[model samples]
Target chain A: MELANIENLLEKYFEATTTVQEEQELQAYFSQDNVAPHLQEYQPMFQCFTNLKAETSTRNVPLQPRKNYLKWISVAAVFVLTTSLFINEWNKQRQAEEAFEYFKTTMALVSQSFNSGASHINYLTQFEETTNKIFKTENN
Target chain B: MKQADFLHTVLPFKDKLYRLAKRLLVSNEEAEDATQEVLMKLWSKKSKIEAYNNVEAFAMTMTKNYCLDKLKSKQAGNLKLVHSNYKDENTSLQKEVELRDSVSFVHEIMEELPEQQKIIIQLRDVEQYDFEEIAKVVDMNPTAIRVALSRARKYIRQELIKKHNYGVS
Candidate 1:
């Protein structure tokens, strides 16, 4: 193909208007051993494309078993995480409830102590008042 | 997709995935990890893989995404100072050195491209995806893909000419 025609096709290719056959033609043109000197820079780009081969591994790594094992591992991780979070929250709530119960008991003990002290002071004042009244009446 | 079938279909592309991961991550260990992760993803979503029109492209996209994720994680971890020294054994020592130079040159130039353009080159050129397939993979219009590819090509050509003193039209 003429350079101009190839250039036109390349332009069409960029425009997304080239047919598959035209694309193959472009690939063929670029794949040639001899390319235009100016376009030699694009040789690698095209060769990279033409030389593109699917990757294969020589090492025989069994995929399915490994994949299944990974799946199980991920599942176990999620399960452990969720379960641990639940347990942590539950422990926190239990600790809070215990603290509140302890606080309530301490407040009750404090109230009882204050009540007993006030009763004892009132009883002493009544005894003093009675003794003073008796002494005053006897003196009169 | 049956697990067996999925493995059978995808196992063949492991090398391609490894190469893509190696190129993108620049570390053999990281590439292997990324490949395993990509395979795990594929295996887990076997049905989705079966639905895909092009499984290889799908796997390539997955591998690229995994590598990019690893890159981002590494960056976030403030570990960008580390250097990767992965070498391929298939090539002779001299050719391996040349390949490393070429890969480094390409990597530096790729960093100058926009993310979209870089990915386009990685998929279309390195991964060898066709335009339509790449368009699907990248979720772009075909015209946009072609333009992006041409622009990327032009940039690489310019850079090569400047760095190597090679003439380009």
Candidate 2:
């Protein structure tokens, strides 16, 4: 608090070399109502700082929880939609497998019935060949 | 972050945010809007806010950026940097500012300074942020911040001295 110390600190202050503690010391020195005669000029700067700090917002808008609700709702909706799509995809795959089984059965039955009809046509061709042989023998 | 937790941690610095925005934007309404906008932005980023070591500093930077962008926008060109006590920058050297009577004389000096120095003074002297923290807000190195801060302090000191000597006679 001596004059010499104040001057030294003020010198550091202007150089921006003062530590926070040193700056606080200077702030404390100027804040006193009865400052030294020589230091009166520097008093107002710190005083202005104090006054600036005093000014605050008249209305502080509290953080709204509604934001969280909306965010969570969107997130939840997305989750549900994705889950439903996944289940639908899974169901489609199962239905395809079942429909493939039914198709295989129907295709197998059609192939078996077509094979029988083909055998009857083979027998008719054999009978036609035997009748041709008989006609040739009679002509000879 | 929880709502109650936000009120405890981030909301504590609302006044600081308001003051910073006020210093940058120079209009109470704009500053108010900036502060609210920053807070709301922070509110949504509550999950990420916890990752920051110093949320207040982060918020300060947000306010600074928001105000700067607001100033650069076309409509805010009319908004003065500070109280319009200073019409002419040249008169500050010759004019005798009544310092003791008006604490706002400091603000007048502030208005005349280059934008960077004005902000450095606000962050360092008024807001009392540490040098590193100021560096983060201003996007400058700490050494650069210190130099700017010193230069700003010196300018204000010289101006105050001039006014003081002028008043004495």
Candidate 3:
């Protein structure tokens, strides 16, 4: 690229009007060993950017340890919840069976009481029949 | 988003995130802390990360806000202002010393810049972000961002030239 173009690009660069390509051209020009004397002062400005970009933190990102623990905690919670639900279901089934058994016994007791009451009514009817026959013989 | 997806999509820009944090916070340890804090916050909200148009811009904004808030807090005293991190290992010893000195000078001038310009310079020059991206991160319009960036570059150039002519010669 011509020095004139670089100069124009540099102006556009400082004005924040350069496209990324033009800025890259400027960066390319400055990065070289043979920069023109007039443009030497601006070298450090872009060089500083390169230097800053090179700076990196070696620290490892601690991602999801707490989240991992939370994951396990949720799994455990779900397991506990399901187990409790199952137990509740079993308890309900057992209660229903007990209720059915109690209901059956009560029904049997009610039927026995009804049968005894019907037998007593039948004996009263037989006695009434015997008294009516005795009155008929007296009248004769 | 899944953990792997979040990592693939976002972790590559960690350095850019770190650079922005360092630019604002000015301390290596604090910047690292800020970066990690921002990443963790992003990770926590990974489910919603897909909702953002640009996760990197959102992350940059978070780092900016966090560093600014840190500066306003009691820990503001911890702010180191500016420290030179540039070291050219391939150069001669004398050139290295000279480079370090010039870098120190630049850091001094950078510390003198207003916070907005300082951030703009970092985003534009160091991170190489476009004006549109910077507008999103800084919450300024594109034209305003361009103007602010130009003003910043002009100020730095003037100061650097002044330092070069007077300090070197």
Q: Judged by lDDT, which candidate is best?
A: 3
From the highest DockQ down, the ranking of the candidates is 2, 3, 1
A best-first ranking of the candidates according to their TM-score comes to 3, 2, 1
lDDT of 3 by residue, B16-103 (tens): 8888888777778888989999999998888899899899899989989998888777365764445455455689988867765766
Report clash pairs, candidate 1: A55-B16
Q: Estimate each model's TM-score.
A: 0.57, 0.69, 0.70
Better of 2 and 3 by DockQ: 2
Candidate 1 lDDT over A1-140, as tens digits, reads: 88888888767755545565776687788889777787665555555554443333344444554446777999999999999999999999999999999999999999999999888899899998998887887546
Top TM-score model:
3
Q: lDDT by residue for model 2 over A1-140, one digit each (tens)?
A: 88899899999999999887888888889998888898888987898888888888877776665445877899999999999999999999999999999999999999999998888899899998998887887546
Per-residue error at A119 for model 1, in Å? 41
Candidate 3, number of clashes: 0
lDDT of 1 at A126: 93
For model 3, what is the C-alpha lDDT against the true structure? 0.84
Per residue, candidate 3 scores C-alpha lDDT tens digits across A102-137 of 999999999999999988899899998998887786
Model 3 residue B1 CA deviation (Å) reads 2.9
